[model samples]
Target chain A: MSDALHDPGTGTPGPPATPVLSATGLTVRFGGRPALADVSLDFPRGRIVALIGPSGSGKTTLLRALCRMNELIPAAVTTGSVRFEGAELYAPEVDPAEVRRRIGVVLRESALFPGSIFHNVAFGPRASGFAGDLHALAEEVLAAVGLWAEVGGDLDLPASALSAGQRRRLCIARTLAVRPRVLLLDEPASALDPVAAARIESLIHSLAGDVAVVVATSDLRLAARVSDVTAHLDRGELVECGPTGTVFTNPRSKRTEAYLTGRIP
Target chain B: MTPLATRDLLGTACRLGAALTLTAAIALLGVLLVQALGVVDVGFLAGAPSRFASRAGVGPAIAGTLWLAVLTAALSFPVGIGAAVYFEEYAPRNRLAGLAGSALANMAGVPPVVFGVAGLALFVRGMGLGPTILAAGLTLAMLALPTVLVTSRTALREVPRGVRDAASALGATRWQVIRRQVLPAAGPGIVTGLTLALTRTVGAAAPLLVLGAPAFVTHAPRTPGDILTALPTQAFTWSTRTEADFAALAAGTAVTLLVLLLTVNLGALVLRRRLR
Candidate 1:
């Protein structure tokens, strides 16, 4: 089912082609109700792309579906193309475990294990048989997120002591430590104060030079600040896609304009 | 109404009621153990139970119960945890798996005596193994199966979904994720179930009787094929015997068994806290 649509979606015109991931006609239905219908977009390598939309506009659905997580939830069915590195992600017998490892996710809800913050960040690398010093890697990643300087001496402190914004960055550091080819973040900075939010935005910009980052958010202002290319989705369809500046400055669809003007959440 | 009076009404009543219930149950355990152990002799620890009512101890019986408890722990711990992992993390949430899961839990509630009969038919007689420690151990395993499984499953289920997700998200295979993340987080709970199951096996007599654990053995059975006597069966036998001395011997054995249970429960508790 996904094979036939890959050619057309993958070939869809985008500025200076060569996308790390090109999803096409990515349809997902939960008990015959389409949560995402024919949602196609491309994410170029080493670029920060944003998926912005209103509630129920298929932002998270598309993000999760791209990694083949629809199958994890009972009664969910995914069809069409979700290609990563030009490889069919939904191909039969392709291990979803492998797909997810290559495509790490920072969930909407922050979660840290019941252990020191060091264990939370080291969780990823340890799972992949990373025999290197986990504490060192944890320190490195935390330092990268500018957390080491603050919490460096207390590496053994419980994760429960961390503030909400710190937990968000720790989650990011955890994902980054795994060295995933693609990073999928769902509302990475939604709960943060302006200062923390700007730091996260800068982190996104810093991450763009190495990995393909796809940030799914309903916050148009955040999308404008973070992404190189922005795609606005409305009711499971890709309504508009362009450079972040062009799309927000002169949105083609009424839905995009409404979203930019705060008419839509 | 005064604020203090209002606060004291239902809340204090409910608190009193709950505390009384807990205290009553614990008191009941103490009374039963003390009564049952009264049959054991004072010198039983250093001596052995005998055919004559005048003789000293229930050493063989204590030994048999120890054997039974240890064997149950050894057999049920790994298998119960394996079953739990399969059901919680690996099994598809289909009708068949769900039914199997419920059936396993229901199996725990089966009568101990019935398990004894099955054990006799299958291991003691049908398998041609005759009365032996293996049959008795297998019988106890059947009886303890449900507690072990339910506890293990509950513990495994309590593990945060994010732990598994994070591991899989980081490219760990299902087995790897379970090994690295799920098992470590859930280990404390599994240990708890095992300790409870072990404690239960120490007191049960019906199934042990069916498996041919003798009422009394002057000498401890050396191997699985040898006939054995468990502490509970010996305590019951001694209490009914026409002798007052055997009663003291049974009391001592009862005390010893209670201590064993306490030790295990405390150890599991400590391990659980450490893990946490």
Candidate 2:
């Protein structure tokens, strides 16, 4: 329930103007159709930001654009600037591999690699050029996610053999292996039961302050409970931005209020 | 009509069709066998093929065919599978790669006789290797290359992308992904392609003629540079003989060739079963 779990690094805070991540007019067009239109936001370190909106609200598109993952899809055209740690992420010399390593992503589908749990957790660190004991690192990260006991003994088993909830936790553990500065998660607990969802929430709570955590979910209860800041998107637009309690308890926009009261998905 | 009666009628018709098809295949095999037995003596197979080979034994021809086939498979098998993996797994899904891949696949179906002329131009006269088993082997490699390449590509393509993505998501480079996940998963298909290409090369004669497989080798060719004598050329020579014994030799060569084909096919079957 506290941010003590992660080491957020040298308490040297940036200028009130120095953002951990800042985007400027990000636009992604797919076959002349606007998937994301001139999206821009600034995320600071030690923050838990919840991206909440109806399905197809371009939250995922925005997330993909941030990582430049949309370029992998043909007919995708992007025009934007994403600066992470004040370095241009889309610069010609900037390697996407490095970007992915520094900024871990967790998809709703749980991108669990088809291998043993040890290998799955070791993936990012290995890809990012981790030279130390990978097995120890995997064990440490799995323990951080409170899954070490369940998967520790069976670190050699296929990932597909895991239960759905365990696979989701393992996915979180896999991302944590890299020790990323910025974490992007989409619907991390939409598919889970209340108990599993609470565990994920606790993990997110523990991750805050050490890393910038961004979660996109339709669960208003989740958005209200865990996040510090809430950004509402509707039809590819950032409709509202404010403190989570303020946004949910006393929404400024009619749409946000309607959404908060279950008038919309 | 009663359900059982309709089922019985359908079953009866299916059985009749299957029986007829099986009988036709068996009869064809039987005819080939009878011709082989009637013309060739058991002595033809057992005796020193090199001594009576020009007239009776087919050791030289058998050796030639095996040499050419083995050399061709050895050269083409790795290259074909590598190309297939590159095209299917590593190549970007763009227009240029698509066009080039299709062009290569189409090249496989071109006539073997044409390949013979190509081999003559590329590996024979052009390279001035001049009728050596090496030249013939390379020609045979070129002839089988397209078939192996296409089959291997198809096999690699059939592998689920999920396995690849899963492996890659876990620190695997593109080549490592292909080696560990894609190739193993698609291995059976590769073996099937290899067997097919090897069989096709064994059955080919026109290319060996262009590449100049020797007709009267007195000794077994252990080296690629040695002039080789393959079964088809020996069979051709024997079939031209005025004596009945030479005709028997040709039939015996055919039987030996058939057995070799069956052996390769069985090996491929075992590999495919192991994959499952």
For model 1, residues A1-265, the per-residue Cα lDDT tens digits are 1232233544564445778788988889887669898878888878889999888988888888877666767789898987776678888857776677677888786467778888787777776668898888888888878788878657888888988888888888888888777889989889789998888888888788678899999777889888999998888889999999999899888888887887744
Instruction: Give TM-scores for every candidate, taking all chains together and pairing residue i with residue i.
Output: 0.90, 0.81
Candidate 2, residues B154-266, lDDT tens digits: the string is 88888775555444443345565677667877888889999999998867878877667656665667788887577776676667777666666767777788888999999
Local distance difference test values of all predictions, in order: 0.79, 0.77
Off by over 4 Å in 1: A1-16, A131-136, B1-42, B52-54
Given candidate 2, what's the lDDT at residue A119?
66
DockQ each: 0.49, 0.23
Docking class of 2: incorrect
lDDT of 2 by residue, A1-265 (tens): 0122122434866665666777888888887768777778887777989999999888888776666556646678888898876777788776555566566677665456545787677766765568999878888888888888876566788887887777888888888787778888889888788888889999999988888998999888898898988989888778888888899888899988888888854
Model 2: how large is the Cα RMSD against the reference?
5.2
| Chain A (candidate 1) TM-score to true chain A | 0.90
Candidate 1, residue B141: Cα displacement in angstroms equals 0.8
**Model 2 residue-pair collision total:** 1
